[model samples]
Target: MEFRLLGQFELRDGDRGHHLGGPMQRTLLAHLLLAGQAVRTTDDLTRRLWGTADSSTSTLQVHVLRLRRLLKATGCSATIETSPGGYRVNLGDDTADVTEFHRHIASARNTDDEVRELHALDAALDLWRGTPLTGVTADWPRFPEVRALTEARDEARTRRAELRMTLGRSPDLQDLRDLIAEHPEREHTRHLLMWALHRAGRRKEALATYEDAYRYSVGQLGLEPCRQLRELQHLVLSGG
Candidate 1:
């Protein structure tokens, strides 16, 4: 069973999916699953569920009980255990999509083989369906933790694009352009776009990209380009 919170909240066991009840239940499940073997304190969970720490702990227990009943009804192997301060969700052999995404990224980075790294990065980005925790709403999704997943997804995209260019694959230049459009200040990805442009024989445009970035930094931000960007521009200028 995979608890998918990558997009919509769904308990996917094979092709069949167990209905995860209402928003509160979905948010609670998202919290515990994201905790990933760590106990989420009762107080922390209450604040997430109700947006205030004043909610009754008994209410939380009711939701946990309902979740357990749902698990038993579906015969899922996942277990929720109560600890001294809070609750922990054990997924057993089953995994969550978020866990798989992180694992894929880690595997990619640890690999020296560029082709293998590209594939792993692809897999990691593919796990995202849409904005994460789309259905799991309330205070939980509003926090930086959920936002971090989206940021990680964005980085995975840029990394994959960089790796593809390194492997001599014809990168989607438009992807890099779109990436820069969204994150002009992201020097690493901008470097990637410059490399892709240089490789594609767009030497003038590549230099112009650096110029545009330079103007943005010096004029708007009153800062110079980083050492890496300057070196890249030097390499591009000498046709290296």
Candidate 2:
């Protein structure tokens, strides 16, 4: 059984996809999975499911029971185990996409082989179908855990773009443009975009990109661009 949380919340059993339950149930399972082996207490689960005031202990128990039954019906080896504190879904050797993504990225960072690193990074980035934890509502995206995961995803993307540039591949200009539009405040991405443009023989546009980033940082952020970004600007200017 494979639990995929990097994209849509889905359970896969050897080529067949199993639906966990409705939106709420899917959100519940996501909360547990995001905990990643740490037991989420009843209080925490309740708040996550239906906020602090609206959630009932009995309601939570009912949902947990339903989720457990659904998992059982799928014939997966994984199970949601109840403990004194709360409940935990033990994956038990079955991998989650999020876990696999992190594992690949760690390998990429550790390996000295650029080819191996690129492959690992490619595998890591491929785990994301759309956004991290798509479809589920109920404040899951607002959770600190989800925020950290999103940050990791973004970092992986930036790393992959950097690696592709190093490998002399023509960078995905439109993808980089979209990323810049999404995260205008992220200077590293702007730096990568500038490099991509320059590598494509668009030095004039590359220098203009740096100027735009510099203005955005100084205007919106009330700060100067970071050292790396400044160095890149200088490199572009010096025809390096």
Candidate 3:
């Protein structure tokens, strides 16, 4: 069984996919999955689900029951185990996309072989179907786990672009431009975009990109550009 939480929440048994249920139910499962093997107390879950810990324990139990039933219906061997403190979903050897993504990223980071690392990075990035936790709401994005996952995704993307440039492959300029436009605060992406422009012999545009980022950082963020970005600006200016 494969649990896909990278985009939409889904459970796949063989070739067919099973729905995890409606938004609230999906939200419950998402929280449990994000918790991994750790027990999430009823109080913690209730607060996450309902914005307060005052929600009835029975309400949480109902959702867990439905999730267990859905797992059984899908023929997934995974189980939702109840402990003294709270509930946890045991995935056993089953795979979750987010977990797999991190594993691949770790392998990529650990490997000395650039070719192997690039392959790992490619596999890591391919797991994303869309935004992590696409449909399910219940304040999912507000969770610390989700925020960390989002940051990891952004780092993976930036690393891939940097690796491609290092390997003498020009990254898609339009894509870099769009990424900068989408995430203006992402200094890493901005730095890469500037580097890509410089590598493409568009030196003036590279300098302009850095200037724009510098202004955005200082004017909006009330901070100066990082040292690496400033050095890149100097390199462009000195015709390096």
Best by TM-score: 2
User: Which candidate should be chosen as best, given lDDT against the real structure?
Assistant: 3
Which pairs of residues collide in candidate 1? Answer: none
After superposing candidate 2, which stretches have Cα over 4 Å from the reference?
Answer: 53-55, 222-238
lDDT by residue for model 2 over 130-188, one digit each (tens)?
87777777665678988888778777778778888889886677777778887899888
Greater lDDT among 2 and 3 belongs to 3
lDDT of 3 by residue, 1-240 (tens): 899989877888778888778788888888888887789999999999998999999989998999888878777778899988799989976888888988999999999887788789889889989878777876666789888987787777777788889888887677677778878988888899998998888998999999999999999999999988999999999999
lDDT digits (tens) for residues 1-240 of candidate 1: 888888888888789989887777777888998887789999999998887889999999999999888777777788889999899998887889999998998999899999999999989988888767776666544677787877888888888887787777877788788878878888888888888888888999999989988988898789998888899899999989
State which candidate, 1 or 3, has the greater lDDT: 3
Report the number of clashing residue pairs per model. 0, 0, 0
Which portions of model 3 miss their true places by more than 4 Å? 172-175, 221-239
Candidate 2 residue pairs that clash: none
Ranking by lDDT: 3, 1, 2
Q: State candidate 2's TM-score.
A: 0.86
